[model samples]
Target: MAPRSRNASAPTKPLLKAPAQIGSLDAAALVGELRQLHEDAEDPDIERMPSDNELYGALLYAEKHAKALAMKQGTEAAQRSAAVKRVLLWEYLREQTDLHQAKAIEDARAVKAEWADLAPVLAVSTPNAAYNKAKRLQAARLIDTAHGDRRLRRTPEAVVEAERRIAAQALAERRAEEQARQRHQLVLPVAQRLLGHRDGLAFDTDAEDWLDEMAAVVDDCHTSTQQVSLARYLGATVRALARLERQTGKPPATTEAARLAYSAAVELLSR
Candidate 1:
């Protein structure tokens, strides 16, 4: 045998392994390793790394997927929070409104009852303008009779002064009575407004903090621009009260101020 070929041995083929699991590894490192394995399996002949455009596409896909997942999770969380808050606030507002409304109604009823009870007494005491005039005429006649029958006659100066004083006092008393009647009438409308305000204020107390956000899905009341309407009204009421205080020489604790505040709160809450 001429020099037998030293060794013509067959080459053994290398076995390919599956991609790594890398579950415990950092995601960034794992992704890098996965890309290397992909390149090796696909084309080991390429010397340079993958193209920038390919890496950019991968990154964009990953970013988009991440953003989508985050958005989904965030939305789910927000919805849960809103649902819970709505339930809690609904109960709170209901209780608050009902309680305040009941109290207001009770108070109003009491005032009405008191007024009713006093009406006859007032009518009996003051009567009408015509009756009041008659009473004055009767009193003047009695005084004149007394003057004529007096044991001691009155001097001219004293009599004239007394007559003038009596006329002045009667006029003053009549004006005072009219003013009191007017004030009483004014109180009725004011009381009604106050009751309305109290109802509204109670409603607003529950959601004043989150009304704007809650208003989107909750539609108990209409809102301007789907935002918290009460906030503006509350502020406006405060300013209005302040102005009233300045103009009327009264403080914010006055019934009118309280009523305005109540109205503002109610308008906002209802909206």
Candidate 2:
């Protein structure tokens, strides 16, 4: 039998190899290597472009390697290096993707339009990468504004400041939450004491109103100033009621009950 013919349609071996030690390269060299790999992958004439999984693997490897290099440098230096890599990657995807130019531009515009929505999700992978990608996409969008007017692109400083603002906002939210939690803890016992006093007073008509007011005050205890106001008002009201009871003389069966309610209200105010 004749020898089997070679399969001319078979895929060729990859032109590039994974680096033995991607971590050995400095940030600049690693970025350059990535650009080269991306260019090779974007051969438009090929029926099938380079494997996306392989490209992603290479990117992940380079990122991890860059991070290792950054650990030895200061944090600021590492952040700058990561930013550079992310910007380069975004630029590569914009310019050298196998997609038609119009499709690529459309995709980029879509990303720009939804950047605010996309940022937090992207940040789950790498904060520096997400920030840099958002900045570059915004800059690209600014290049062509309405009426052929090109806006000034954001500076690196602006991007860094934006990131700082996001971080600061996150911190402020956390502090607010902690403060609210503390206020709730402080107000809960006072609210319970006030409810007990309502029970002891036994004013059928006023009990519902008092309970509603107490509920409103408890709801507003998220703020320290509001808590203080509620506490003072409740204390004053309780004291007035206690004075009235003393003047009128509580029934023997309810004298101790009135005293306990008055004592609780006093303690709630002191706290």
Candidate 3:
């Protein structure tokens, strides 16, 4: 048979095998496998190399799993921090009132309610602001008591100098308080105007127009302190409007009023 032609023989078919369970592998093992797959893919003689698409998919899944684990860890950490803060707050309340746990907790709730009530007056909008103010007030109390009767035995000149310093600090504090009060007064009329719009009591003036005018006035405030005060007042006003909305169940009016107030605050602060 003309020495059976070698080229006429049937070609052998390569055996197909199932892919490895990459998803079942741990991260390190998956990475190692991927590295080997990469090396195999780079080699010109290697057949049956892992597909680049499959390796990429495994890498993406691994990265996603790692991110999810990190997020879970972050959430746990935040929860722990919040729990610690609560414990510290409760302890502080107990020391202040010398109350047992039950009473202290009850008193703490009452204090929180009082803070809510004064939020509008003090222009304390956020929980963090209230917490910081509480800490500052505590520190001030400690400082005031630190000198106590120790200043009674100084020489005449020293006593006079100390008196002058005390007077100066007092004057500065009073001036700051007065300035804040004046800024608050400037905002009160705007808040009242908005409230009138909410209640349909403002004559012929649209709520939005009044809000714009108030914003213009805030923009005109030259000092940083004045701008900050206006922003804080607006934030408090928005919170009050929100509270009123909840009480009245008039979502449209209350929601719009809050939106305008918040926008005004944001505008002033951004400048």
Q: TM-score: which candidate is best?
A: 2
For lDDT, the strongest prediction is 2
Q: What's the residue-level lDDT of 75 in candidate 2?
A: 50
- Deviation from native of the Cα of residue 87 in model 3, angstroms: 53
| Candidate 1 lowest-lDDT run of ten | 12-21
lDDT of 2: 0.49
Question: What is candidate 1's lDDT per residue for 120-212, written digit by digit as tens?
Answer: 533444334323332322222223322443211122333344456578878997776665455434333433344344433322332243333
lDDT of 2 by residue, 1-271 (tens): 9999985431211113321212222434555555443344342322232333344444555454443343432455545655576666555554433224334434655676454444565453555555455554443333222213333234434334444555787799888767656755765676666566554563433434545666677655656666555655565565555555566676212446655755666675566
State candidate 1's TM-score: 0.21
Quantify how close model 1 is to the true structure by its C-alpha RMSD in Å.
Answer: 43.8
- lDDT by residue (23-72, candidate 3, tens digit) is 22233443454434333334232233334345444444333332232233
The local distance difference test score of model 1 is: 0.39
Error of 2 at 1 (Å): 92
Best-to-worst ranking by lDDT: 2, 3, 1
**Inter-residue clash pairs, candidate 2:** none
Which residue pairs overlap in candidate 1's backbone?
200-266, 230-268
